[model samples]
Structure formats: structure tokens, C-alpha cells
Target: MEMLTVLLVVIPLISAPITAIIANRYVAWLITLVTCLALAGLSGVVLHHVISGEVIHYELGGWKPPWGIEYVIDSLNALVAVIVAFIALITVIYGSKSAEKEIHDSQIHLFYAAFQLVILGLLGMALTGDIFNLFVFLEISSLSSYALIAMGQKRQALVASFNYLMAGTLGATFFLLGIGFLYAASGTLNMADIALRFDQFSSMTLVITALLFILIGLALKAAVFPLHSWLPEAYTQAPTMVTVFLASTSTKVAIYVLIRTLYQVFPNTYWEEMLLPGFLLLSGCLGMLYGSYKAIRQVSIKRLLAYSSVAQLGYMVVGVGLNNEAGLIAAIVHMFNHAITKAALFMAAGLVLMRLHTTNLEKLRGAGKTMPWTTGAFALAGLSLIGVPGTAGFISKWYLVQAALEKGNYVVAGTILIASIMAIMYVWKIIETLYFEGPDKLTVHKVGSGKEIVPDLPVATFCCYVMVATCFYFGLYTDIPLEAANTAVEVLFSTGGGQ
Candidate 1:
């Protein structure tokens, strides 16, 4: 079971090179799919083992922690690992036909290779016990993401990638510098070791500076408001599948790191004394309102979703900022729920792009009637985004409201409600476009047939179904995810009892 920890990172890293070497595109995709599936399965097994009271630890090259590299799978990391793997598996399946359409034929294999590397990097970040190792994996994922976004055919794709590169590099550098400060102060690179050693620091200034740098770096990476300028263009111009994967996983990983830092690395007394909780709560509230306001103004469907992501991230931050059991649970649950819902929505959008050759809201007129299933899936995901009753989004919001109320913060509860309404506005915009308007005036070109007809690829449709089913399944029966989230939260706040 301990060895399984290494496999999560090793499998995808190995498969990436193999994918690039493969001659056939189909074979390359097959390799990527198989590897992702294996990762998901392994993650599940590890999660189960952890739940059964096992802590899996693997030392790299047989070197013990505090001296050498180590992988630690606690309840929290295991849950996140499983979520990352599951999302990657779904994205890879969805990428098949979509990639073929959006990317050059000769570059398809390289795309898969980069895709695997991104997954590998995410998993590595989740499982590694060292802060420096986290930065290393962060760069791997960021570089691959830049390449993936640049693969888009849009004229602005290169520009968007370049912008993202600059922002992402700065964020990574800030994070690296913070880690360097901690290592200088604590004389250890291991996260667990640092946690134990952090108490030795008497200088509040050093701690504050380190925390600020890390928080800002992660906020930039997570695209938190005021630092999220790179996201809309990146999402709008990136290949649809790349957008979906990044939307669902990348920022969520950043949030995971934030949680680890706040609840695990820093002392509870330090957090409370600095008023970090209140600060985060205020930032989150502002981000939620700001992101939603921006989202409502977008004409491009992808850009709309991109802005909505900023708002959604704000909700997660609210949960974390609440700094209580209910708040933490809400954050974790929202993280998972949003991932599935957003993935489904993006996949549906990708399908529409396949048929319409455009993601402009006006151009997507009558997609609801022409592509009923895809459009229906989008509507379902949109409802989830709105926190409609019986959807996964509702559960997260429900908990968030409860958390805010528990703290006697009626303002926070009201903010959550207002954010939900804002989400409805943006979501309804797309829904109205799809259902109320007339079909696109342009003739549709058949995929691979050179005929003037709708191009409804089976692979793309299947991908949408997979995502939609996941959204609905997780929404109605919230036991598994809810339970996992609760357990993970328990681990986060157990030691720090709001002191």
C-alpha cells in the first residue's frame, strides 16, 4: 500500500514519454487513458486503505523523512488525490475526439504526453510531504498547462499562454521564496517536520512575511480575485479539453495547498492572533461578488465560465476562511462538487464548439434544440452552479450558510445567498441563448466527412454523458463525497480548535 503512493506520480510520468513516442494517435490516446484509469483505481484503493486506519508512507530511495524525500498519504491528501485522478480520467476520455478536432494531427501525440505530465504534476503536488517538492511539481504542471493553452487555434492563444506563463511563473517564484524562508528559519524541508518546528520561531515578522508570500502566491495560482486577470483569456482561448481539466483540477489543488498551510503548517495560535480567518473571510466575500459581477458581462460562453470560476473559487475560500469545522467541510465539499459540475458544463460547451465552430453566445443560438443532450447537460450543470435544490452545488452552499450562521455572521450567510443569485444570472444567460434564440445561420460542416451536416461525434457526446452522470449521481447521493469531505475537514481542524 505504501508503494502505491509512488505509483500515482510514477505511472503518469512514465506514460507521458511513451505517449509521445507512440506512432499512432489512437495508440497514444489508449496509453493515456489506461494510465489515467490505473491512477484512479490506485487512488481509490489508497483512499480505502487510509479510511481503514492506515497511513501509507513511502520514502524515496529508502531515505527517511527529515533527511530525504517522502510521500505521505493522510486522510486529506488521499481524498484530494482520488479527486484529481478521477477528474483526469474523465478529461482524458473527453479529450479524444475534441483533441482531434481542435489540434493539428501531428501534434496530437505530444498533446497526450503533456496531458499525462500535467496529471503527474498534480498528483505529485498532492502527495509530496516536502514544500519544495510541491513547487517543483507546480512548475511541471504550469509549463504543461501553458503548452496546452497555446495549442488553441484562436489568434490570441499564444498571447494568452504567454500571459499565463508570466503570471504562473511569478506565483511559483513567490511560493518558492516562501519555502526558502521557512527552510532558512526551520532548517527542514519536510512539511510535517516544519509544522513541528514552526513553534520555535519567536519573530512574528518572519512568520507573517512567509505566510503572506505563500498566501499571495497561491491566490495568484488559484486565480483569486484581483489576481485573476490571466484566467479569462486562458480559459477562453485554450483548447476546450485543456480548459475543462484546468478548471476542474488546477485551482482546486491550490486550495488544497492553502488548507494544508493554514491548518497544518502554521500554529493555531498564530492563525488566530493574526486575524487570518477574518481576513480570508472578507477577501472571499469580495471575490464572490466581484467574480459574479464580471461573469455576467461576458459575451463569450467560455469567458463567462471563466469568470464564474473565479466566483466559485471565492466560495471555497469562504469555507476555508470561516476556519471552523462546518466551514472547512463546506470548502472541501464545494471543491469536489464544483469540479464535477464545471467539467460537465465545459464538456457540453466543447461539444457545441465542435458543431458550431464558435463559442460566442450569439452564435450558440438554438443549440438546446439541435443538441438536446449536450444542452440539457449544460443546463443541469448550470443549475448545480446556481446551487439549485437537489444538486451538488446546493449541498456546499447549505453547509456554507450553516457555517456562517454558526459564527453569528449573518452577513456571510447573506453574501452566500447573493452569490448564488449572481451565479443564476450568469448561468441563465447561457441557458437563454441556447433555448430562446434561433439556430446558427451558418452551414454546419461534418467532421471528417466534408459534408454540410451536424458533426455529432460519439466520443464527444460520451464524454458529456460521463460528466453529466457524475454530476447527477454525486448530487443526489451525497454520502460518499460528503463523508470524505467531513473526514478530511476533521483532520484539518482537529488539532486547531479555533484557539
Candidate 2:
């Protein structure tokens, strides 16, 4: 069990270079599939142990904590790890066709290589106990993502990737400064060690500065509004598959880090003493309304969904700020629910992009009649996004409303309802364009035979169906994420930092 920690990171780390060296695109994709499968299985095992109330702590090279690096597996990180790997697995399976279509044949292997590194980085960030190591992993993911986005079919992808690189570098700088300030204050870099000694230097002004820097850095990475300028273009310009994978996993991981740092590394009292909770609540509320409003106005389906991600992220941030059990549960469970919901939505969009070669609202008119399976999947996932009953999105919003009301924050509660209404508007825009309008006959593709045919993506469509089912299944079940989130919150708030 203990070896599982190193294995999770190592498998992908070793495979990445090999996949890059392989010239065959098919071979590279196969390696990626196998790697993701292994990661998903290993992550599930880790989550299982964590859910059973067992924490796995592994010292690097037999070095003890406070003096050497460590990997700590608790419910919070374990669940996040599972989400990352499972999404990667499904994405690799769904992406083979999409990748072949959008990327130059020469660059496909390199793309898969970068994809593996992104996984490696995300998992490392979740498992490592040292703050500096977390930054290292962050760079791994960010650097790889930049390259991956740049490989998109459109020329604008290069510009979008460059912009993302600039934002990511700035965020990493802030994060590193925070780590330096923290080390100066606590005389340690290990998270558990820092937590244990945090109080001794909590009164120092440097500690407060560190916390602020860290918060800003993570908020930028998570694309909280006002710092999300890079996301819309990136998600819109990147290849269909790249957008789907990153949309599902990247910001969610950043939010998980924010949750862990606030609740575990520092203290819940920081929420009160520094008035951090109010700041978060305000930012989150603003982001929610602003993101949703922007989403409703986008003509490109991909960009519309990009703005929608900002809104969904706002919900998670709001829940975090509420600073109660219900709020924490809302935040954590929403991470899982939103990952699947958004992935399904993006998957459906990707299918349309693959078939029609465009995601423009005007071009995709009447896609529901021509591409029924994909359109149906999009509609179902959109319901979840709108918080309709019996869908995963509803579960997240319900908890959020409960948390807001519990705190007597009627305005925040009202903001949530309003955002859902805004979501419905944008979602209906796509639905109406796809179903109610007439097909753009001139844009439809035809073969030499002059016969119209819709291409089939059996595996990809199946993957989308699987994701859509999970959205409904988890919404109804509720226990899986709730149990993990409840235990994670308990551990985070416990004495001794659950170490």
C-alpha cells in the first residue's frame, strides 16, 4: 500500500519519455491508454484505503518528515487523485480519434507525451507533503499544458497557449514567493511540519503575507474571475480533446489545493481572524454572476462552456468560503460532480466539432437531428449544469443553497439561484439552436457518392454516455462523494493536522 504512492507518479513519469520517443502515433496513444488505466486503478485503491480511515504516509528515500520529503494520502487528496486519473483514463479513450483529427501527424506522439506529464504533475501535487514539491509539480503540469495547447489545429492556438504560459508563470511566481515567506516564518517547508509550527509564528506579519500570496496564486490558477482572462481563449482555441481534459481536471485540482491549505496547513481560525471567509464569499459571488452572464452571450459553443466553467468554479469557491461542514461537503462533492458533468458536456461538443468541423452556434444549428446521440448527451449534462432535480449539478447547488442559508447569507443563496437561471439561458440557446432551428444544409459534408452520412464515434460516444450516467448516478446516490468529503473535512479540521 505504501509503495502505491511512488508507483502512481513513477509509472507515468517513466512512460512519458518512452511515448515521446515512439514515432508511431497509434503506439503513443496505446501507451497513454495503458498508463491512464494503471493510474486510475492505483488511485482507486488509494481512495479505498483513505475511505476506510487509513492514511498512507510514505517517506522519500526513507527520509523522515520535517527533514525529508513525504507523500501523504488522506481522503481529500486521494479523492482528487482518483478524479484526475479516472478522467484521464476516459479522456485517453475518447481522445484517440479526436487527436488524430485535429493534430498534425508529426506532433501526435509528442502530444500524448505532454498529456502524460500533466497527469504526473497533478498526481504529484495531490500526494506530496512538501510545499516546494507541490510547486514543482504545478510547473510540470502548466508547462506541459502550454505545449499541448499550442499543438492545436488553429493558428490562434499558439497565441492562446502563449497567453496561458504567461498567466501560469505569474501564478507560479506568486506561489513560490508564498512558499519562501512561509519557510522564513516557520523554518520548515514540509506542510505537516509547517502546520505544527504555524502557531509559533502566526503572529508574524510575514505569515499573513504568505497566506495572501498563496491565495492569490491559487485563485489565478483556479481561474476565479478577474484572474480568468486567459481561460476563454485557451479553451476555445485548444483542440477539442485538450479542452475536455483540462476543463474537467485542472482548476478543480487548484481548488483542492486551496481547500487543503486553508483548512489543514493554516487553520480554520484564519477564516475568522483575517476575514478571509468574507473575501472568498464576495469574490465567489461576483464570479458566479459575472461568469454566467458572460456565458449566455458567447456564440461559440466551446467558449460558452469555458465561461460556464468559471461559473461552476465560483460555486465551489463559494462553498469553501462558507466554512462549515455542509459548505465543505458542497465544495468537495461539487468537485467530483462538476468534473463529470463538464466532461460530458465537452465530450458532446467535441463530437459535434469532429463531425461538422465547427462549434459555431450558427453552423451547429439542427445538430440534434443530425447528431442525436451527442446532442442528447449534451442536453442531459446541461440539465446537471442547471441544477435540475435528479442530476449531479442539482446535488451540488442544493448543498450550496443549504450552506448559504445555514450561514444566514440570503444574498449568496439568491445569487446561486440567479446563476442557475443564467445557466438555463445559455444552455437553452444551444438546445434551441440544435433542435428547433433548421440545419445549415450548405455546411453539411458529403462524400463522392453525394450521399450524406453522419460519422460514428462508438467508443467516444460510449465514454460520453458513461460520464452522463455517472452524473445522474452520483446525484441520486450522493453517499460516495459525501462520505469521502465528510471524512476529509474531519481530518483537515482535526488536531495534529491528521498526521
Candidate 3:
């Protein structure tokens, strides 16, 4: 209990270099897997403690809060840490097989090591109660992600990696500048302490500027529209396994930072104002419509999914814009739902890419009959992405609608409905390419009922199935995310409680 928070950062931070020392790729992968398993277990335990109405605060170097670095676990951050670790655990398990196919044998060990660092950075960012510590971890994750993305088979990956580095560096800079402003104003780095002191400088120009800087910085990392130019290319050209991990973790952590900073460090009146709401709503609407539109026109299946992610991110932003309890819960739940669904979808993409050596929609025609399990996974995840009834996505949309109605924001509600319809269009195309399309493009034939052929990926199929099953499980048994999100909202907004 005393060491849980520090261990969350330490275990994986130490494991990365140790895993890199291994000569064998498979051995390195196993080491990384074990590391993720431990972290996942720890995250679950911490979440259990937090949900049981206990907060754990661990001070670094034997110093207490407001003077030394702190790691705090309340319902909000505990839930985020769990989601990050859970997705990372799944990615490490799922990526081991996919990495073997996508990356060079010589570089595979480094890939696994960098993968651990990325997970370490994300988990650390979520667990840290210090603003400056968050920035440090953010850099770690960003640096590791650049290396992983550069390991892609495509030459274009180098350019994508460079673009990401540039954007991420700028984002980190903005975040640091914001932190400097806050420190100047309050002379504290601890988040709880800063929150307590916010009132002292609420009317100062530096404080508002600090908030603006932080918001812009996080938006860049979160791939919010206008600043999201790096995401599509990065996702498209990165190794399939790398894409799965980044798609699941990176932006979600950025969103967590944004949520925490606003709710914990700023006054409610400032955060809930027209400027913030209007900015979020307008950007969300644009990204939702524009991203889905671009997705529909994409020839590459991976690129299609990439654009779809842009739209999915918009839904999360919209949930934040609503600024109500239901809206916040909608955003938090969607973060989990989207992370798992995107991870599964990307896993399905990896499976198809491994078999066909391509992710072109035309090249993958009729693959559903051959790799039925893999395609089934893709189809199911796609349904969740579309917010279909009884799927996790639907629950998020339902709450978003309820919030919109409660706020009397019919336009935003209608926009959400329209976005869901757009999701249907893109996802239907993926399904059609998988199933109804002919197998005229197949060059290699396998023994499957004597007619159609596909690659047998039982392990990948099983992993993907497990991901899809969670979509169904969470949809029907909504208590987990709902309860956690509601608790988070209550704690965050309760008078004097955010501190």
C-alpha cells in the first residue's frame, strides 16, 4: 500500500533498460509482458482501494506534500491509471505476435523495450500529483513513441515520426510554460496545493494565461482539431503493433491531463464559461464531421481507421464541452470504450495486414470468409465504434445525449447523432470489404471449405475476441465505468474536495 504509487513508475521505468539488455526478441517480449502484468495488477488493486473510499498519497524521498513530489490516487486518477495499464497490458500481449511480422528481427528487442517506456510514461503521468512531474512523464512517453513509430516498415514512417516529434515537443513546451506560470503564481508544483492556492491568484492575468497554455499544449497532444495534423500520418505509417499501442494510450493520457488540470486547478466558473464550451463544441463538431468524411474517402484501411479515430476523439471533446456530471461521465466512459475498441480494431488491422501484406481496402476484399474470427473481431469493434445498440459506444452516446438534453443544447445533440450516422457509413464499408466483396484479389489460397482462403491467426483471433467481448461486457454491465465516473465527478466538483 505504501509503495503502490511509486512502484507504478519505478517497476516499468527500471524494466525498460533491463529488457533492452536481452539478446533475444522473444525473451525481451516475455520480460515486457511480465512487467505489464505486474503494473496491471497494481492498477487494479489501487483502483479497488480508491473505490473503497481511501486515497493513497505517497511522498518521494521521505518528504510530505507541498514540499516534495507526490503521487496521489483518488477515484479520477486511479481510474485513468487502470485504463492506461489495462490497455497497455492488452497491447503488450497482442503486439508480441504482430511485432514479429512487422519489425526487423534485429530491432525487435528495442521495440519491446521502447514499448515498456511508453507504458511507463503514460502510467506515470496518470499517477503523478505534481504538474511538473506530469510534463516529465509526458516527454518520456513522447520520446519513446517517436522511436516506436520510426520502427515501422514503411519509409514514410520516418517523416511521420519527425512530424510527431515536432508536435509533441511543442506540446511539451506549452505544458512547461504553463507550469512555470502556475509555479510563479502559487510557488507550488503539487496539484492539490496549487488547487488550494488557486483562489489567491484567480484574478491575475498570468493564471489565465497559464491555463490557456496548458489547454493548448494538451490539445496538441490529444490531437484536437487544427493541432491534430500529425495523427493521421503517424497512425497510417507506424508499425501496426506500434499503432495499436499509440492509438490506445497517447491521446487518452493527454485528455486525462486536460480534464485534471481544468477540474482540479481552475475555478468552475472560468472552466464552464462560454469560451471553453464554445471552443470545444465547435471543434468537436468540425472534427466529427470532417474526420469521418475523410475516413470514408480513404483507400488504405489503416488510414481509414486513423481518420475514424479523429472523429472518435471529437466525441470525447464534446462530452467535455457539455460540462455537466453526465457529460463528464460520458467523456470518461468513452475514453475507456474508445481505447479498448480502437486497440481491438487496430489488432484486427494487424491480423489482416499480416495475412495479406497490405491494408488496402481493395486488397482485403472477402477476407471475412477466410479469416472469419479476425474479421469478426473487426466487425464487432466497428459496431462499438458506431455506437450501435447494446455496445459500449452506445452507452457513451446515450449519456452524451442525456447531458445535451439536460443542457437544452439540441444542436450538439443533433451533431452527435449525425456523427454516429457517419460512423455507420465508414464501418459498413469496412464490413463490406471484409465479407460481401469477392476474393478475386487473392494470390495465395488456403484450405477453407475448398473455395475461399485466409491466414489462420488463432492467437491473434483469440486476443481480438477478448477485446470485443469487453465491449459487450461493459455495455450490459455498465456499473463499473458508470460508478467510477460518477464518483470521479462528485469528488472533483464537491466544494473543497478537488484539492
For each candidate in turn, the TM-score is: 0.96, 0.97, 0.96
How far does residue 141 in candidate 1 sit from its true spot (Å)?
Answer: 0.6
**Which pairs clash (backbone N, Cα, C closer than 3 Å) in model 3?**
none
- What tens digits encode model 1's per-residue C-alpha lDDT throughout 1-499? 8888899999998899989988678998899889999999999999887863356789999999989989988767788888889988888888788898888888999998999999988999899988899989999999999999998877799999999999998998888888888777878888888887676873647767887888889989999877889998998899988999999999998998888888878865687778988888888998899989998998888889998999999999999888788998899889889999889888888888877677788666776777778788899888888998888898999999999999999999999999999999999999998888875444343333222477667877887778777777777899767877777667666666311
Predicted structure with the largest TM-score when compared to the true one: 2
Q: Which stretches of candidate 3 lie over 4 Å from their true place?
A: 444-455, 496-499
Q: What are the per-residue Cα lDDT tens digits for candidate 3 across 1-499?
A: 9698788899988989988888689899888889889989998988888875567889899888888898988777788888888888887777766788778999999998999899889988998888998898999999999999999877999999999999999988998999999889988999988888777877788888898899989999999987899999999999887898789878988888888887887766676652787898788888899889999999888899999889988988888887778888898999888888898899899887877677888767787776777888898999899998888889999999898899999999999999899999999998998799976345432222332344466776778888899988887888777877888888777743344
Give me the candidate number with maximum lDDT: 2
Superposed Cα deviation of residue 468, candidate 3 (Å): 0.6
* C-alpha local distance difference test of each model: 0.85, 0.90, 0.85
lDDT of 2 by residue, 307-342 (tens): 999999999999989988788889999999999999
Least accurate 10 contiguous residues by lDDT in model 3: 443-452
- The predictions' CA RMSDs to the true structure, in order, are 2.2, 1.7, 2.3
Candidate 3, position 417, lDDT? 92
As for model 3, its CA RMSD to the true structure in angstroms is 2.3
